[model samples]
Target chain A: MSDDWSAEVEELRLRRRDAMALGGAEAVAKHHERGRLTIRERVTRLVDTDSFKEVGTLTGQGRYDGATLKGVTPAPYVMGLASIDGRPVAVGGEDFTIRGGSSWSGDRKKGGQGGFIEDLAASYRIPLVNLIDGSGGSVTSINKRGHSIFPGVHGFERSVELLGKVPVVSAVLGTAAGGPAGRAILSHWSVMVDGTSHVFAAGPPVVERSLGQKIGKEDLGGTQIAVDLAGTIDNRVDSEEACFAELRRFLSYMPSNVWEAPPEVACTDPVDRCDEELLSTVPKDRRKPYNMRKLIGHIVDNGSVFEIQPTYGKALITCLARMNGKVVGIVANNPMVYGGAMDVKAARKQIHFVEMCDCFHIPLIFLVDVPGFMVGRDAEAAATLRDGMRAVYVGLQATVPTYTVVIRKCYGMAGMGTTEKNGLEFKIAWPSAEWGSLPIEGGVAAAFRRELANAPDAKAREREIEAELRAMASPFRTAEAFGVEEIVDPRETRPYLCRFIDAAQARIRTSLGPKAKYGVRP
Target chain B: MAAIQVKADVAGSVWQITTKVGQKIEAGETIMIIESMKMEIPVIAEQDGTIDKFMVDEKTAISEGQVLAVLTR
Candidate 1:
């Protein structure tokens, strides 16, 4: 009986070895040559050292001859529970070396294992980090297995359930087309390696065949296309290590689940440390472009601003930062781009960013300098108004505390979207701030065009009208009319923002509960 | 080296031209300023280069992605 038990143990060891080999030594070497880490290697690097406890190591495709194994066993997917920064998390990745990481032969086993991991994370309320590198579903499987069954709402239902419940992150390390791409986007935050990763609904071959146009894989779904142009993913890092670092930073600002509040660190930077330079940061001459980034640095906690999509939406700046040691989302208008007007792209960017912040229960700080939504035939063609309306709708729906600071130009519908009309808790403005239905320079021409055209000196009359409108548009008048709550000095911004955070901290804590209604939309 | 085209990122009217043809300019030096959406955006040189030519004159309306100048590195 002892000899029989030893032989059975030996067989189990051989099966485990085969499953661990992935596609084989040569295939793994090829994968390395292309500058990609294996599935196990990625998971090891992502999690805390020696903290990973794998869930399914011996489950894979197997072949046998009367109880004796004859071929290599392939798991194709690896999953486990691990600790990241001493906090528990569930992680999984596709073994791309096996059948190109396609869901072909062992999908039933893969789905069972994947579902188990999701369930484990959901039950324990831990973050889920997926490192996806697959060829999505395989066409060859159809020929070999005589077609597959289609179930409505099967793959993404688990992800949807985990959306408002816990944080989900995905790192696209290699080509992630079709279903894998969908998973990457479904996560709350996603990062892709610059050159090695690509994501798309369909690869170039499928597009060429269907649309009769030739295109490269990089052009179709490279980091630049997916992140900068399409805004499909949150970030694009130079390497896998950078991607992991970004994930760690992003998760730091979020709770393990919505059941908890974001962790707070001790405040090191003095809340009242105001820079006198902020007084002159926004030029008195509204036409001059001053750096808003510099102003943001002086207001938030020192070195705590982490900008998101800095390149895509030039006019609207969106970032995550710490105000008085509490995580907050910052949205400011960049005067360097279109005079900080909300263009179609900028509107879409703000709408998406606001939705993400609202879903995570992060309070928002709006530093408005919007002149108005972009105006012209080009803006009309871009459907700027449609996107602008969406931005306003999302801005109003936000349940988190919203603090608005009208730093400069705040006019037209774009200004209205900066804060709710029902009086925000901290809707204050600076001396440089000015708000109106429209800018005097552009509005004067349209409103008194006929009068100017008929005047003895059309140019002089135009100038006179503009001067009168400018005086009426002063921030003082808005205060006198009770339209603006208060106008503080520029130097008071830091202290005010810090005070708002301190005052709202208790409210944020009390607001923590089940986020059953606000599941994030992909 | 290839000639780099300095492009306007937003639709606007050129307010001023800061650099002249044949003038050596450093990377990120403003070549021209465009007034749009009630603010001025500077079109900067991408690399250290000599200005080859101006593509648009002051007060000329240029569309987004339109080339404002050519610079030869």
Candidate 2:
């Protein structure tokens, strides 16, 4: 007898086919009918073609008839190693077709909090991409297990550790609640598809049962709430295809890991490509608002500006762009929104961007046009001061080289945050730039309050003081005093910034690795 | 014709009404100038349209997201 292993090998092939079927054809068809891609489809489309090498494919509950095995039902999680844009990354997602992608207890987890995929990313020091589409733990698990597991049984220790070591990206592909939703938030940057995806602590039924307030899923946790209003998710797109493209675009600027420098592409746009419109980008009329987005487009490399939190913080523009083919974080204030005041939302946005850039050793460029922290009773009630201070606090702690270009109005503590005070303290400005403890218009009124009140023409007296201070506030005067490093022609902004950003690469290279922050934020 | 409502992005008073009712305005044309935080913020038409009506007059106090005008495209 030739002890042939052909029958056992055939059984292995059949079990693999069952895993590939994924909750049977009926469930997969239902998933597709909803205009959503299956977990397998999502993984294939996101990574480079022919790049996915899946792990844990054979893990599932097995059925046996006496000594012969019948079939296997694959676990609700799929993950493995893959490459994005030629660099290796660990990617994973929940298989929503099986039991609504609830938490599956295998001998070991494939993906989720502390999953094996996370371990792969941490060990290899590569980026981790999580395509989240799960409802997480269910009450029915208790009946199957005979006891309920503790909350931290599958803790986020690995998720949190991966943030400081590698770039972690999360995409909410479908309705996410409980553990999966919490896992999505732990990523360094996260995105969600509009109309099809929703993420929250709990779903509508749970909210209604607990709070006595009935709400639809979309209304409770749609892109409007998660991305726009709350700033929980960083970006949103029209379709899943666009979401995949965005994810690829974002990782292009980031390094594979914090231990390395951010990838730089060849520059086709000339470093000295000076645009004449930059001279007049800021309106001569102080009260008039021009398009900051257009201004940013002109300065950065052609078609290289990817805005982060574009909808959430209208007052501030935060983007990852290339200067001289080198990656840079642009933090520019929007003059159109409340005169570019640092409101609570804008402050929160600034803090996150600064920290992320610092973590990856990316240089920062500040295009300052902020008036100050937002004013009025509403601003105070919203904790604008605390948040604004926290923004400044992070800015101070950031060790990365920062270049400050005062475009127009830079005033108060918000203005102070833009400069690299602890490091090089390099600042360049345009002719229109003005900075002080406060704007001259508001300062004159307060400083000479009694003097103006006593004067027969209070309005005239106030105007006289404002005019005198405004003349002294010219950027040229500051340059003459060497208070600001230099004042350049507005048209020279691109060439000048490119030169400095290129020069700062040496400093950035030497400072590569994980950044350790100290002190408590206000 | 489809009527589109234009809302204020910031809370302030109407400084000046730059467009009139029934005026044919192109996209990005200033509908009005709002004075908030001592800055003149222009409320521009998002699409090419004719001004149907002005919901708030010059110097009228307005809140954020308040409908400032309606335009028929």
Each candidate: what lDDT?
0.83, 0.92
Task: Give the winner by DockQ.
Answer: 1
lDDT of 1 by residue, A153-230 (tens): 246777777876888888999999887788888777888999999999999999999999899989999988988878
Error of 1 at A186 (Å): 1.2
Q: Which residue pairs of candidate 1 clash?
A: none
Lowest lDDT 10-mer window, candidate 1 chain B? B37-46
lDDT of model 2 at position A470: 86
Instruction: Give the per-residue lDDT digits (tens) of candidate 2, residues A299-402.
Output: 99999999999988788999999998999999999999899999999999999999899899889999999999999888899999999999999999999999
DockQ of candidate 2 relative to the true structure: 0.78
Give me the candidate number with maximum lDDT. 2
Which segments of candidate 2 are over 4 A away from where they belong?
A: A1-3, B1-3, B49-53
Best by TM-score: 2
Model 2 error, position B72 (Å)? 4.6
